[model samples]
Structure formats: C-alpha cells, structure tokens
Target: MQNQVRQLLVSLQKQLSVTLQSNRETLCHPVAKGDATEDEWLCLLKNHLPNRYQADRAFVIDSEGKLSEQIDIVIYDRQYTPLLYNQNNQIFVPAESVYAILEVKQELDLDKIQYAGKKISSVRNLKRTSAKIVDVGKSVAPRPVTAILGGILTSDSLWNPPFGESFQKAINSLTLSQRVDLGIALLKGSFDVSYTEKNEVQTKIEVGETALLYFFFNLLWRLQRLGTVPAIDYAEYLKVIDELS
Candidate 1:
C-alpha cells in the first residue's frame, strides 16, 4: 500500500511537470488572486482517496439543524445513509450520508480553532446518539463516523514549542478515532523574503521561487509513501493536471 501511494505521488509530480511545461503561458501569468493553494490541498486529498471511498460527498450538519454547514471534504461508503434528528419528536429521520468530514483553515485563528473543536464535538455527539437510537429501534450495522481536521499551518509559532503544545492540546481534546484515524497537516511557504541592514542601509533579499514547488512536490511524495493514495497511473494523472490547469 505504501509503495502504491508513493507511485501515485511520483505520477502526480510527473503530471505537474508536464502541465507546467505545456502551459508555460498560464504558469508564468500570475492570476488575479494568485493560486488557490487551499483548494489545491483539498483537491489533492479528494483525488487521492481509494476508489472504495467516495471523497468530498458529505455535508456538515449542526446539532440544532438551524444552520447548515457544509464540510470541506467527506468520504462515504456506498451503502451508508444520512439521518437527521428531529427536535420536536426526538427521533431520527433520513437526512444525508457522510463518510468523513474535512475542515480546512488557512491560518489558525482563535475563532476558527474554536469552531473546529465544536464541529468535531457535534459530529461525535451526533454519532453516539444516533447509534444508540439505531440499536434500540432497528437492527442494522453500525455506521462509523470519522472527522478530519486539515489546514495549512502558516503560523511559525505553531511549529515551535509552547504554541505547538497548546495547539496539540486542543487537537487531542477532540473525539478522534481510537485507531488514530484523524488526519492533520501543516503546510507552510517554503520561500521567505526579508530586509537586512547593510552599512546602515537597507537591502532586500528573496528566497528561491522553486522552493514552494519543491515543498508541494515533496508533500505529495511523502503522502504517497505513507500509503495515503492509490497506485499512480501516469496517463490518468497527467489528464487530471491538464484539466486543472
């Protein structure tokens, strides 16, 4: 499985290279909003899931159902069904099916962090209550719910000591699967630019632009190596890159 995943990453890299070469104009021309880096991460995860897992097809529901929140990504088994709890009757009804929930954050803000924790808690409570109801009312297989929190950890403090400790504490408080099925990713810009004082004057310097590309490429490669994706198909992989480009 791990080897297959690596193959997929390698295939993706090859496709990326080809796409960049073929679409030199597009690559060179900066978009009005630059690149959709967050969306790219979501897409990569969605596309890499095994065929058995239907990724990004689930919706997010609050405990009260008053506000509808859509998850960033979800994967579901074909047989799974969705259900909603009715406050009036205290009963569960067919609502929607969800395999997993994905949350994406660009920067770790306090509000977003709190929201993430609440989302996980809501999903956990829903699953537990629903399971009890199902066991008592109907004889059916149990439905497992998994929650995934993923984002670009752009904060330097998060990668360091005390801040990282706090962040990890918050994460560890969530109702994660016993198998450690939850996923978390931290992505940062590989290139940095700064100004330095030279002889009482200011000077500007920039890191290599290619560093960002390398970071992404290596990310894909490591994920593949970790068996997060299926075996690579160079032809199909290139096709995806072409479509995205």
Candidate 2:
C-alpha cells in the first residue's frame, strides 16, 4: 500500500513539474503563475492528507489580533480552532490552531529562502494561547504552546547542487525564530533541520528522485508527533483596554 501511494505521488509530482514548466513560459503575470503553482501543491496535499488537518491559503491571527503576512499554505487544526474570518473569499485562522506554514515558489534561491524566513517570522513571533484539552467535552487549564513549523515548497532550484552552498548560507543566516524546518525542491532535493538536546541545529539533505515521498512522509510523521494544536484560549482575545471619555 505504501509503495502504491508513493508511486501515485511520484506521478503527480511529474504532472506538477509539467504544470510549472508550462506556466513559466506562458503565464505573463508572475503573481498568477506563483498562485497557480501553490494551488496545485495545496490541492495535492488536501487530497492526500488526513481530513482532520485542513490545508488552505489563509492568514494567521494571534491572541493580540496581530495578522501574519499571507502565507502560501497554512496547515491548521479546524476541529479545535475557530475559523475567525471568512467573508468574500478571504479567511483568517487563529495562531493557536496553525501547525505549519509553507511558502511555495517557482524556483528555489537565496532571495526566495530569505523571503520565506521573513514570512515565517511573522507567524512565529505572534502570541498564541493554548488551553489544556482534557477530552472532547471536558477541558483543563492552559498548557505550554507547541512551536509552529515552517517550510518552503518549490518546483525547481537555481544552485548547482540545488540544496548546496547558497542554500546552506541562506538557512544559516536566519535566526532561530526565522528558521525553516524543512524544504522541498521537487526538481532537485529536500532539506530538513532539527535541534539537538544541547540546542545545536542539525541539518540533513536528501537528493534523489524520491525526495517528494521522503518529504511527504516526514511531514506525516511530524504531524503525528505534534498530536494536535491545543485548545485555543479565547480569554486572550478579550482585551480589557479602557477607553477614555
């Protein structure tokens, strides 16, 4: 079953590449081209991933009512998090519900990586409040919030080895809050970073035709490890600011 699923994903990836190639040559509007590419990946993920975790293009808002820059894709827990804003095609999700954010691009490069970092920081820096979920009907006190993951999804790479020198340089330049946990350059390879017990960051690079399969399954494992975003603490959203007469 796993082999069959991976084979289908590989075939779909080939189609995604073809779509990107066609858009690169025919789509004059850069933004449209980028959106189309993102939408394709988003759809693929939606179809393959579990329905409990919803993936969509939405802005993340925190308890302080701060909004992150529009992320290309947001994987959120809809079961526990309230869909804050949804009107006229625009949507906003609570930060406490966001598990991960992905920035999709046509090609992988230094500039794109830096841009993804900035976008990630916007969401990472926000204040998220969590409540302990005792069960479906019962609840307890708030708990420590989990870190939100971030990454990049690209159709191709610009560097020689794709995930080589320039890629490492860009990743190293980012601060802890701006770190991108994983990335996939479909035409080349995938890169992942993790932290050690001593707080040192460890990075791994996998370059092969099965990069997408590796990336996808790793993501599934991460989702399992994360469990679920804790219950959102609505009290944090109730600001008690006094108004002057």
Candidate 3:
C-alpha cells in the first residue's frame, strides 16, 4: 500500500511539472494562463488531501464580519462548519474552518513571495469564534484556533541557485504570522518550515524534481496535526450582523 502511494505521488510530480511548463509557453495571455494554473492546483488539492478538508477558491470570513483577501486556494472543513454567503456561484467560508491557504504563481521571487505573505496574513489575522453550544454533550469546550497553513506554489524559482541561502533568507525574513508553512517551486524544489523547541522558524529546503510530492505530504502531515477547527458560534455571527444592520 505504501509503495503504491509513493508511485502515485511520483507520477503526479511529473505531471505537475509538465503543466507548469505548458503554462509558460503561452505568448500574450498571461492572466488566462495564471488562472488555469491556479485551477490546476485546486484540483490537485481536492483530489489528494484527506477528505476532511474541502478545497476551493473563495473569500474567507470570520464571525466579526471581516473578509479575507480573495484567496487562490482555500482548504476548509465543510463537514463541521456551516457555509455562509453562498450566491449564484460564489461561496464565503468561515475562517475557523480554513486549514490552509496557498498562492499560485508562474514564477516565485522575492517580490511575489512578499505578496503571498500579505495574502496569508489577511486570513490569519481574522477573529474566529470558538463558542460551544450547550446542547452538545456535556457542553464541549472550545477548540483552539488551529494554525492555518500558508504556502506558495510556483512553476519555478528566480534565485541564482534555487533553494539556497537567498531563498532561505526570504523565508527567514517573514514574521511569524506571515510565515509560509510549506511550498513547492515545482521545477526547482520544495520548502517547508519547522519550529525549533524555542519556537524559532527553520526552513527545510529540498532540491529535486519530485518537489510536488514532498510539498503534498508535508502539507498532509501539518493538516493531520491540526485535527479540526473550533466549533463555530453561528449565533455570535448572527448577533454581530444584526448589530451592524
């Protein structure tokens, strides 16, 4: 079973590499190509990550009525959290349920890296509700707000020697709230951040053609550790919305 899974991931890495290369060949339609790349990533997450997480592209919301920046990929818990603000074809998910958010780019560089950090911070900084309903057996305690994994998915890297000190420096420069938990510079390599006993951030950079597989599994481990998001206090959200109106 383990070997079969490994083979599948290896094959997927190769396919993702080709997808990125094909996106680059387009001459004048950069925006369309970018959108397609993001779509491809969404599909990958939907197919691979544990069934507990639901992946899509949408704006994340919190109980206090704050909305996150439009995210390229949002992995949330549809099983335990209620869906709010669904329209003709749009959906707004609660921040409490989001397990991860990722930005997709054609090429990753220092500038784009900073942009990704900002996007992630917007979601992480929101106010989430953990209020438990009394009807729940013995009044369940509120679950801690699970850490939302932030990442970037790029076809390639712009560093002279990708995944070297330069890339490490970029990862180190980010504040704790803006740190990228895991990522894949597909054609170059994969990177995942770890915390020391003292909570200092450490970047684990892996250079190889099989980066997508590395990125995917590292992400899976992180998600598993998070367990589940806090039970949302829907009544709180309703009360706040009424006050605003």
The most accurate candidate by TM-score is 3
Worst 10 residues of 3 by lDDT: 132-141
Return the lDDT, model 1, position 214.
Answer: 44
* Pairwise lDDT winner, candidates 1 and 3: 3
Give one digit per residue, the lDDT tens place, for model 2 in 26-96. 88999888888888889888998998999999999887768999988999998877898989858899899
Candidate 2: where is the Cα deviation over 4 Å? 133-139, 240-245
Tens-place lDDT per residue, model 1, 34-140, is 23433454466567555544544234443333332444444443344433443542333222334344444444444455565555444444422133224467865
C-alpha lDDT of candidate 3 relative to the true structure:
0.85
How far out, in Å, is residue 87 in model 2?
1.4
Estimate, for each residue in 8-120, the C-alpha lDDT of model 3 and write its tens digit: 88888889778768877863598888888998898898887778889988999888879999999989999989788779758899988898989989887887788899899
**Can you give the TM-score per candidate against the true fold?**
0.42, 0.91, 0.92
lDDT of each: 0.38, 0.85, 0.85
lDDT of 2: 0.85
Pairs with backbone N, CA or C atoms under 3 Å apart (clashes), candidate 1 = 6-224, 56-74, 82-96, 82-97
**Candidate 2 minimal-lDDT segment of 10 residues:** 236-245
Model 1 lDDT on a 0 to 1 scale: 0.38
Query: Model 3: runs farther than 4 Å from truth?
Result: 133-136, 197-199
Backbone clashes for every candidate come to: 4, 0, 0
